[model samples]
Target chain A: MERLWNTHIIEVGFDKIVEFFYRMSEVADKLRQEGLYFRYGPERLPEIIRIPERGTLRVKYGFPIFQKYGVCMDVTNVEQALIAEEAGATSVMVLDKLPYDVRSSGGIARMASINRIREVMDNVTIPVMAKVRIGHYMEARILEALGIDMIDESEVLTPADEERHINKWLFKVPFVNGARNLGEALRRIYEGASMIRTKGEAGTGNVAEAVKHMRTLMNEVMVLTFMSPEDRMKKAREYGVPYELVDLVSHLRRLPVVNFAAGGIATPADAALMMWLGADGVFVGSGIFKSQDPHIRAEAIVLATSMWWSPDIVLEAQSMIDEAKSMMGIDIRKLKPEELLQVRGV
Target chain B: MKVGILAYQGGVDEHRYMVVEACKELSISCEVVNVVEKHSASNIDALIIPGGESTTILKLMKRFGVDEVIRKSIENGLPVMGTCAGAILLAKRVKDLKTGRVLQGTLETLDMLVIRNFYGRQRESFEIDLDIQVLGEKPFRGIFIRSPAIVEVGQGVEVMARYGESYVLVRQGKVFASTFHPELSGDTRLHKYFIEFVKR
Candidate 1:
């Protein structure tokens, strides 16, 4: 019955996080203020948790993972996750969009890709994640069935058979969505998306202005309907809420949904800003990959992520982090890595 | 400020958003209020009852407190806007949604044929361009979310707006009503129109 349900947008009064929580809790006893929505504490974004030099222990409130020196990485390979861990990433977002026909390739199919992700999960002690598309609830459920931590419910990609494919709210799995604006983001949360990532207007390398725009918009909307920032955080904390994507979805009751911010994060300062703007964690992509000092920047990101949430403990890494050397050395023309080509946005 | 939106409980978000958006676009402060609240009438500068389950709204509003405040507000000339269930509330004689008893509420404010739940069920919700006579310019893109139809208009009632065969929008003094949700109708011209009417 839940699979084919499509919701027509309706306007209600101010989004009532508490009222919604109460209503939903009344319906589902397990959620009785249980708030089984987000991964709390410092281990939230375990992808970058193991960065060797950049791993700091600073923590921020509300975001999924804002530690003193938070560590996170985007990886197609397990080894890269290790490197990110060594550099200081708590969690690694696995973003190799599996080929539409994984069976066509002898190496691995999309389903098998999850197996490989599982291997990475096995190798790492921290939480790991993979991406899925809207309406692809089956694959997402299967991913959750395999015990992979969180699924990035990406909007940019979908092999959905039809628009009638309902939201993942019906499933027992945790779902996340990447949204550029607040209204839609909150809607996704209500629909059972556990995680929320910043849309970041992908493909465009421009970061500063776009990220700031997102933060400003969210700030206004959140403040308009709910308690002040400090009070909201305290309440969320009192409820044992992570105020992360997964938590917001589980707590959906016409309230301000909590989610980690992602996309267009290009600097440690940007990572810091996401925390400042109420993000639970930061997904650093172009910022880490395109930095002049890749290793240093990556380390800086991990450090900044952790410290951004805390007033104390600024990043002062002792070990020399590898600045991601110019990728010009890797002969992209020589090697036929289609994944790299996709990143080129050609 | 405790802005009462008729939680007709069918599809409330659209109307809630329209008013919120209008206030946002116009920089006026507002919030969705329960018309059922006893305190809402005196507390709010205005009221909007969105398009929704008329039977549910009528019964619930009365069970709650919307019926009283509405009459009190109209008597005091406080601005009250009804779209669909809201429109029904402004009617002098509403066919008691359940018993079909044509009972009278305080509303003799507008002259119009008010039909209850004219747009059948949920499957009938639709969208169409409306030529709102009051705007005197561009048409209002009416997004009818389970809308009722205004079957007729009385003499004093200015047929301010219509979509094809149905009177989608209308107004009367401090009491403005529409069969379709003008608040949900994407265009702020109606909200702006209400604001202008209220201000004047």
Candidate 2:
């Protein structure tokens, strides 16, 4: 062991160690020039931030969705983002239009303006997520350059590509996409999505589709969990995702990524019910703003989400919202097949 | 045993998940307290300050009066465990690594002095297996994210663990602070250890 150690030390050589220090000193000198001071021994060594040179992204840079009952609110502007922060939202999804506005505006809903996203980023302390068109790589690039926390390749934002989704593996930050079933969820995971949300009917202010999607996804996962390896492989092939992802879902019996319920959550009870149905969290947009009191309703939704297991707390949360004042919720049955956002992405 | 997590800011979900998991393993009851206001801090056996951006957390804590409430609660025997940014807030003094300026809004609950971003910037953030003797022979995986380093400690402070030559975890009475995030480490030992500490 001692001989091997000496041989290892000799092979390492003093010159390489000196060269390492030389490069380190160069970096330190640059940092010194930058006016940043160091606290420990020697001079303040300016650190060279390690940038990944190659390989598949580790899904490290996205907003953390492992939060217990995280509340993700959809905000169109800075004021709403601030209100979300005040209301205990774990993160805010910045978009140009909520589903309500999208349904009513009847125009091509694209990514929110860069200036608007910037204003929200500057004013907020919590993680800020923005949406890009389903296949608009440039919009995702712009959001990435702006140092946005997460990007949603959303169908609600009008599909930028008809046949393909953004290659999420190409980006440094994480992408979240909506999935209507286990296959869609797994496909998105194979595409490098770090988080998944149910592609429920947006702006509808109803929770049926969200519930349906979550149920369908979970039930499918259970079936996959019980399948044989060959069967799972066949299912993976059928779903157009890798077998490894399918294997992971089989073992975990759930989506490998954080699964959240989004699109039509309108009340605190609606949020809690989604949580009880195995959703990691819920995302609300028109629900809070379209209510009698956004401040109270927002806080109530956040409360119900966090205390989902407790019926009494959920009841308390329910009492805070005025049911009559909620947004005019559109039933999923009324929506024509062409208007279904869930059917947009793969 | 009932434990509370300060959920108004920073890794609220991550910490709550880990702590709740810890409580489940330990077979104890736990509650996540969203410390958006002073009253929110009441009625918990212990409190956990999760990792996140320290300045923003401090600013929010002060704005919502959670800082004072936490101070009083800790004074009144509420055992607290602060990780990463939480450690910075608990320190008596926080120094900026860039300018060596004393940053404001610290709760001064812990006796140590900390230097922010001592582990470097976000890009330099990393994870490593640490030898914390208290956690037995197994190396504790410490996740350091824009983490600070505890450079100095008062006479009352006890060094719980270290990485290299710097102190990473320290305790002063019921107050425990760690410069690394245990919640993100996927290890339950630290949470279990903290829960045991809280139980005592």
Candidate 3:
């Protein structure tokens, strides 16, 4: 055994053998903790794994989408996806079941089927995004391999892990994550989320939670602007995010990434309200699909989001949809604690 | 001077911000307006077509009757600049890179042939620094997001920059177009150059 050890060390060198064993231990440790590890050859790891320079991913992915499309509509099939594109949506999010359906039919919600996503992608000329359950890195990988424009490590879908999230930095495709406040936004940005959206009570068709979350986030940012450097550092620690990010937020008076309001935005008025409250954009899920006229409602919401600053245009947009045709809203307060999707990833 | 940003869709704010910054640097008084309708399009001293979804912007422009106004303004020698999708709109010919067919309904102001999504999808988007003599000795960092590429330019068009064999920036008469977004780069040189053209 001693002779064999000496021969092996001589052939591969002590440093290389030690590194090999150390890497193997890491893999074993990861397997034990997470139940799986994507194995790649050591030489090719650097090329496969990427750490985005600060703000690069956001500039390349998030900013373009935010600037181009003030509204991202959710769709379940090829027809809805086409309607979304036709209605002038800048982007569309694909789902196996719309948020309303997810809320109605209680089950383990995962990423949409690959074929379904492909069908949507094939049908639409606009950018196609889809959601993967929180911490489901394998599903993220599949989406990335499928050439998805963006991935949402979303709370709308059932989380795969209770306490962890997919390390977004590992993927080439930009990710959008849901955050309820400044801390969550910064944390997701630190974790390499290129975009951040408010985690309102999705599928409820009630914009109150969405409004509350946006107000909280913006108000927190306002508070940060008044803090001293030392107080800011303390706040950063309290938020469990990097002080640098906190500093950036304080100086910029906004989240460094593109922030969109999502969850329970059901009407043109609701969409305009979020935009007026300072969302770069918005995401409508059940709001459009569950409405009386999905096509007209979608166009109205798009117009409202884009022209939120102009009251007359917003009024025009509001008149395009009928309130009676809107989705029946749920009182978020009535939902049990376990039924909340917003609290899942948080 | 008043500048109109074709604000129906896409990076409208970014261009407005950059143009304002450029004006400040040049000590020129400029008012930026969102050209949502025909009147706004007609009243501008200069126009900017921002980087966005070309089809969406085209649809909105036609819907609001801003497309004809813009076409007429350019015909009357209005200094205009377009980036990415904006560049696609200005091109005389636009070909879809995926389908290898001509895309119709662009403003067709600039004398160039642009291929849409020449660099593939979002995952294939990139950023790079280019040497443009017009912008002086410094390398301008170009942010390209699913950017188009200028495959051909007419006799009147002057190529300003190139990435590989394709033209990324071009100019003909008073029209300027770039396949990569200059507004996102936070560099004001391109904006300044266009401002100078407008000034002239």
Candidate 4:
């Protein structure tokens, strides 16, 4: 409480702080007039470029998807990518797993597999994403440096590293992580994962049981969140009632990405329902082509998922189903779900 | 009379568009060349280092073994005009962020600062009117896209234009630099100036 002020402290101290603020203000003003600031670093950009968003909505959404989606088509054929593309599958997953081998193999074999994926990318117009074994963030960066659009941080296969999966946030390129369940999805999202995919019990190729399993889980999920079909419609209705409230899409866009209904998508309706219940998209394995109606059902499922709410979209989807079925010699709609026992715990 | 546009990265397309149109009106050939890997020095009579990620493109240039090739080409006295970050790379001295001090990027190619992304960020990008001294009479339009500021310049650097206290344009013999992006503005005067410089 002593008030003796025969000191140089205020004059020396506050004056410099005041001068510092004034100089900062001047620098800011200069930047306003001059467009240049003091250096931060050379390796990083002083700014991002703001070009117009040129692509369509699907394309924009798909940009990060295919750029980073993992578990690529294990096949050598590039045309096989067309199946995923036409299904509006954002990307074809390239798995490094030895497709036939119960035993995974050598480094040269992995590189050869990668080269084959590169060939597929060259033949296609869309961006190509690649995979890195978990905890392999350095390798992921190398892939990005090679002009790869994305990386899949999937747990489906990693070379049994001693450490935890490499954190995706450390890399700049978009990364898609495999979410085995809802908890994992949220965990990865918290860990700065930009995208997520449901882990389909892959490679077994049993179509119907998988579809039913996913449907049951999605149904259970509807009860747990505000993303239920009825609730989403209700929210849309509430927004429409105000009609003047802006930022409907902006808010929707920020919701943690839940694209790709995973595990089991046995039928087209299941695909539509998944989209209805707030999934950003769906992943089908054994669901479409492996089903009895290989072509028609796949097209219908794709169409329904792509254009869930709009009837005009439904018709277009139907036509797509028709065309795909005729072209591929498989009526996808005719494929019935495979039956299986419900494990008591599952 | 085909003009080569260094298309390694950044706003290469914008400059390519500007130069190509300038060439079309002047009946000169202009091509956007991926100068990092795919070009020989003799492929074009003159070069325009377009505004862009200067470091990334320069990294590619070094990785692809073209940095010295470019330095030698500039030394041989080819007319070169660099805009924004492009201007920075073409400068004889640049602020090397690694050492927190100035270092040489070019072989005294342009006696200018060519500060990298002197502008703060994309939101800071803008267009401004300039009182350019070299154009000789009229006010010229300028677009600055994440442009670098010329904090200092050597004696050979001619301060060609000023926007308030900041030097917006500078020229040193065949080399010229502007902190603003003239290509993005769609103004032909800068291109015309470079063409005239090349002709001289």
- On lDDT, the leading prediction is 3
What C-alpha lDDT do the candidate models reach, one value each?
A: 0.51, 0.73, 0.79, 0.49
Residues A233-317, candidate 3: write the lDDT tens digits: 9999999876766876776666656678899999988987887677877899999999889999998888887767678878998
Compute the DockQ of candidate 1: 0.02
Over B89-166, each residue of candidate 1 has an lDDT whose tens digit, in order, gives 677655532224453443455666665435532223444556666777665555544345676777667677766677
TM-score of chain A of 4: 0.53
In candidate 1 the C-alpha lDDT for residue B156 amounts to: 69
Expressed as tens digits, the lDDT of each residue in B35-55 for candidate 4 is 544355556678777654444
Error of 1 at B98 (Å): 65
What does the interface RMSD come to for each candidate? 24.5, 13.0, 15.6, 20.6
Docking class of 4: incorrect
Q: Report the candidate with higher lDDT, 1 versus 4.
A: 1
| TM-score, prediction 2 | 0.72
Poorest stretch of ten by lDDT in candidate 1 chain A = A53-62
For all the candidates, what are their Cα RMSDs to the real structure? Answer: 23.9, 12.5, 12.0, 19.9
Task: Indicate the residue-level lDDT of A307 in model 4.
Answer: 44
Candidate 1 local lDDT, A8-82, one digit each (tens)? 123332223324433453434444348654421112122222221111111001112111124446666677666
In terms of docking quality, model 2 is incorrect
Candidate 2 chain B weakest ten by summed lDDT: B119-128
Preferred candidate (DockQ higher): 2 or 3: 3
TM-score of candidate 3 to 2 decimals:
0.87
lDDT of 4 by residue, A1-346 (tens): 1111111011112112223223434544566458675421111211222332111111122233222111122323465555544333434554444222211232322322557666765554333566665656666767656545556664434333435555554444556666544434444543445566655543333333334434443443333344545554554354332111112222222223424445455455555555554444555544454444554555465455544545554455555543333212223234333211121001
Model 3 residue A204 CA deviation (Å) reads 1.4
